[model samples]
Target: MTTTRICVDPVTRIEGHLRIDCDIRDGQVVDAWSSGQMWRGIETILTGRDPRDAWLYTQRICGVCTTVHAIASVRAVEDALALEIPLNAQLIRNLIVAAHGIHDHLVHFYHLSALDWVDVVSALKADPMATERLAQGLSDWPNNNARYFAEVQSRVGKFVASGQLGIFAHGYWGHAAMRLPPEANLMAVAHYLEAMDYQRKSNQITAILGGKTPHIQNLAVGGVANAINPDEQSALNMERLAYLKTLMDELQGFVRRVYLPDVIVIAALYADWLPYGAGVMNYLSVPDFPRDTKGTDFGMPGGYIPAADLTQFHAVKHFGDPYFEQNVKESIKHSWYKGDWTRSPYDGETVPEYTDFQQDAAYSWVKSPSFADEPAQVGPLANVLAGVASGHAGTIGYLNTALERIGAITGSPVPMAALHSSLGRHLARCVRTQVLYDMMVENYQALVANIAAGDTTSFNPPTFPKGEQMGYGFHEAPRGVLSHWVVIENGKIKNYQAVVPSTWNAGPRNQNDARGPYEASLIGNPILEEERPLEVLRTVHSFDPCLACAIHLHDNARQTIVRVNAF
Candidate 1:
């Protein structure tokens, strides 16, 4: 049995740099390692800075997850200062989160992960009429006509004819893992382009609510900075709210009729994937989209599921629950850090001790974040499952709807347990998106109604204490549960650490050599072609690994000095 080492360095289409190393034997991955190849010392920079301004700096951690970090940062400061945000601010922030979630989910599926399963080259062979029929059967998407598909096919044909695959390059197009039919591929490709427009619309909604994109400027320590006035044009007024409503409606339609159906179609076609990529069964999710100012009532539920057992699940009722706060610890045992001790995030340190990559030693820049000394998968699947366990009506409804559609497509039952795999991650994202769309409308209406009731306040300026105070902010970000831990001393930041989603999913082995989610998921995956390694990409991409958010940046202007030796 010859064991071969396969390295897919700099996995394309993801936000930042990541490398996957797998030991393949008998055409199956026997062992694997997930490496985040850059160092992001955002926490270090936040030290000694005003806690209020930490959000502005931490938000720059990643271009994709900027809004999430900003929100989390402010919440952390607010938590430390015991600041209570206004009703209007809570609602406004919820809207921004929902909009960002929709945009990020769509981008992940259509732009980043779809090509892993979709055969773009085969799409050129798809019959436009058949593709149109397929599209209509799936959803009432308006662009399902033969002419539209034909146009998409023609564009793809020219792209293929030019021999410049452009974005489609470096993909294993004709591999055995490309299970989707030509018509399915064509439909996915078409929706992929449609998603770009919808993505922009989601961003537009965020801009309206947050006053800008990428790094939103409206968020303050206690709440948001948006001035609510019904008749004023410069404020979050009637006209802006009306325009925002239109964008939400359009995005909701696309999610319901297009994105959800596409995920189901792909899942049904690749049903074999249901058995693989079921990484660590333990999951974590945080409650988000607070419906009330006190945050006692939430639009989405949060909890911890140990070993995928709904029976043993524990729900996190509010922000900074002891169940969450006390259990979360970051281990630098197998990371590029100076210490081997597992410390809580409140006391977490990010002292970098760079060593050359070692297979059995430090291999990644991401510190191993564990819940109760155990590695848990965190993301859409976790959030959805946690919601299901906690009897969240929206989660149950959307999940049932998704499972029913998948069952109908596959002509069999796709159980709730099926959500533990790669296909399930995609389906769970669609389910979560559906739930968020409903909540988006609900929050928007609440915000509008609040302003009409003559309460236009959106912020509560925080007053810091004299001594040191520690607090962490939690957000159910697009990736998963993101927490920013900060210790404030004399109104300035003393210590800062971010236990991001990617760190939970993509970090290296902990003190016990326990694999992270990405490594565990790749253990039994079938490597159809070692060189192409499409199966590996599918599993990794399912996690939506954002190394840019996990590890920091490197100088791309300088040439990498490492030499490659081919065997």
Candidate 2:
């Protein structure tokens, strides 16, 4: 069989530059390489910085994933000092986390990855009334009317006529792999435009709580900087809380009525894609939304499920669980780093050595991260599966509801095992979003009740000891499990390493020379057209790749760089 090597240089619509190389044999990807075409030296930048101020710098690692990194940084410092923050702080932080997650998932589906499955040009051929009928049958969202869809269609038509698709440009329109009908395409496009508004509303909650969106201003070592006083307008008072509830209500409605339903409909329509993209099934996620100050109890459950087997689940109990710390290691063998050894994050080093795109050797800048000496996939799918394995009621309830809806659409029962595929990742993300909505409401109420009880404290000052201490903090971020490891020496950061979600999923071969999740998932994925690999984008986009978190840009010359392309 003749194999064709295809190179998708700098996969667009993602956070950072990522080059995906695949070998196509008989229209199927037989082998693949996932490479992060950048380097992130944030770990080395914090060499001798103050531990308390570490969160501020770390949050800048990625503009999109700022809040998660901020939260993880502070938690790491707190864990190292064994500090417990106030309950009010915990609740406030939870709200920020949930809101950020909701906003991220919304934008990812509608704005980023939706174009892979939805054909914008085909929507131009759709009947507005037919699209309205299809949308109304799925959900009672108020905008599901012919007039509204017609207006949306007109707006899109203008963009097309102007020859400036803008965000909709560069799409593989009319591709053979695009399976949706014209009406369905129009409906998805309509929802895609509406999603922009709701995602902003979700971010408002984060801005209100965290003082900003990209790089939140409220996080501290011990707790959040948000003061509480119902009578004071400047503090986190009743009026702000009420406003937040209103935003939450709007977001929850969209998630239930629009976002969740949209994903389910798309998944059902693309049911044939359900069997592909389930690779490196060793799942790993960490417990988040802490209910207590010591970081022991959580509203959401997270653990490890090895080899796609739910029965072999192992929960990482607390803040500094030896189970997690002892097993986490990063191998630089296939990465563009100085070392060739697999070392724990505590002893991790990030010295760059650029050896451009060596397929048989070092290729990616992302270090291969492993758990228990194996590549474990991390993301919403991992979070949902871990929750289901741990018997969490909220996760189970939402999972069953989504499965039933998909099954109803397909005229058959969707088994739990089916969730181990591409469409399953999309479904699992929706399930996680629904559960997160409930968590947001619960945390909001808890914050109100606590404040009503006259407990308004949100911060607890930290006192670092005069010695070296190492600690790790893990958060089940929007992408997956994001952890920050810190070695603090006399109040200064000795060493810092962030094993981000993308690092786990988008990495190169591990120490055992095993393909990472992204590379492995691409195997067996069909490439309908050699020149235009729309099928390739469908599976890769399912993971919501954020290479910015996995790698970073380092250009010391400060020169303008441009690459012209002829498509």
| lDDT on C-alpha atoms for all candidate structures | 0.89, 0.91
lDDT of 1 by residue, 1-567 (tens): 999999999888898899999999999999999999998888887889999899999889999999999989988887777677798999999999999999999999999999988999999889999999999998888898889999989998888899998777777878987888899999999999999999999999998887789899998888888888888879878998999988987888798999989998899889889998998999999999987766667889988999999999899888767788999998888889897889998888877888978988998999888998999999999999988888889889888987888899889998888988988998998899888898899999998888889999888778887999988889999899999999999988899999999999998898678999999999999998888899999999999989999998434345685668999
Model 2 lDDT vs. the true structure? 0.91
What is the lDDT for 119 in model 2?
92
Clashing pairs in 2: 39-552
For all candidates, what are the clash counts? Answer: 2, 1
- Score candidate 2 by TM-score against the native: 0.98
- In candidate 1, which residue pairs get closer than 3 Å at backbone N, Cα or C atoms, i.e. clash? 39-552, 40-552
Residue 411 in model 2: lDDT: 96
What's the C-alpha lDDT at position 411 in model 1?
93
Error of 2 at 32 (Å): 0.3
Weakest ten-residue segment in model 1 by summed lDDT: 553-562
- Summarize candidate 2's per-residue lDDT along 1-567 as a digit string, tens digits: 899999998888889988999999999999999999889988878999999998999898899999999999999988898899899999999999999999999988898899999999899899998988899999999998999889888988999999999889989998999989989999999999899999999999999999988899998888988988999989888999999999998887799999989998998898888889988999999999999988889999888999989999999888888898899999999999987999999999999998888988999999999999999899999999999999999999988988899899999988988888888888898899999899999999999999999998888999988989999889999999999999999888999999999999999999999999999999999899999988778778888899899998655465665567899
